[model samples]
Target: MAGILIIAHAPLATALRECIAHIYGGCPARIGALDVLPDSDPVEVVAQATAEIERLREDNGALVLTDMFGATPSNIAARLATVPQVRVLAGVNLPMLVRAVCYRTTSLDMLVEKALAGASKGIQAIGPGTPAPEYGCSPTPCAEAAADAAEQAAAGATDNVKAASGLSAGVLKPAGAT
Candidate 1:
């Protein structure tokens, strides 16, 4: 199984871990969370993070998740990319973390794909008019709605690309005033 490390601003990393624990009823092995404090020294943080990476790494390698790109945690995570078998992904969210934890037994590359899918699939517009199923209120119904939404989103993206490139199989709109 691949190891997972979460590096984020103070408290976010630890909070995410705790949330995962809450969901899973227990914290899984080979997972570490590092909270970077405001007054943290980058060099020391790197050292500490490197040590965590070493401890978490296995045959399948380790995955590092950070809160935001271009931030301190992600910058620190960037330094660890040179470490063999470690992949760093920015924009850490609950869905992404859960996916990474659940698929820890898979190959590192496949785990990355699963994590990315989980992150994107987890995002939705929830409002008054949105269906409860799409809001993930129930397991089976939510899964079905989510699957249908994913399919539609994919097809819509394809159509959008085609239209943008003037290759759509439909009448092209003439440039005109709104």
Candidate 2:
């Protein structure tokens, strides 16, 4: 079994662990959240989280999940990435946490993929189109609704990517839109 660690700004780590427990029951021997203060030195906090991570690694190879890419938690995790037994992922969310706990026995690479996929799926919007066809929804109309919903989702995803890449949504000229 793989060991999991979560390091995040403030109380995010604790909240995420609670969410995982709620979704899949409690995880045995997993470490979540380093005890630190807002005014605590960054290096000290990192060192604390790292120590816990190392301890968990003794039992099994460990995966560290953090809240943001360049934030303190992730930066601390990055420093420990040189350890062959430790792998780190940023942008940890409830879905990713749940998936990690669910697939704790899987290989590291597969677990990372599952966590990423779960994070992506977690952000999706649920509407009338997402319900099952057996819920008194007609097949043909349901198909059309699903297609429309998917198209909207794609558009939203593209907009988010563009925004993250520092491109203004209005700056991108659609091929067929004026």
For this target, which candidate reaches the highest TM-score against the unseen true structure?
Answer: 1
Measured against the true structure, the TM-scores of the candidates, in listed sequence, are: 0.76, 0.67
Error of 1 at 100 (Å): 0.5
Error of 1 at 162 (Å): 39
Instruction: Please list the C-alpha lDDT of all candidates, in the order they appear.
Output: 0.76, 0.62
Cα deviation in Å at residue 18, candidate 1?
0.5
Give the runs in model 2 whose Cα sits over 4 Å from its true position: 35-37, 58-60, 127-178
C-alpha RMSD values across all candidates: 13.9, 15.2
Off by over 4 Å in 1: 134-178
Q: What local lDDT score does residue 8 receive in model 2, on the 0 to 100 scale?
A: 82
Instruction: Please provide, for model 2 over 81-113, each residue's C-alpha lDDT reduced to its tens digit, 9 standing for 90 to 100.
Output: 888877889998886776665445445776687
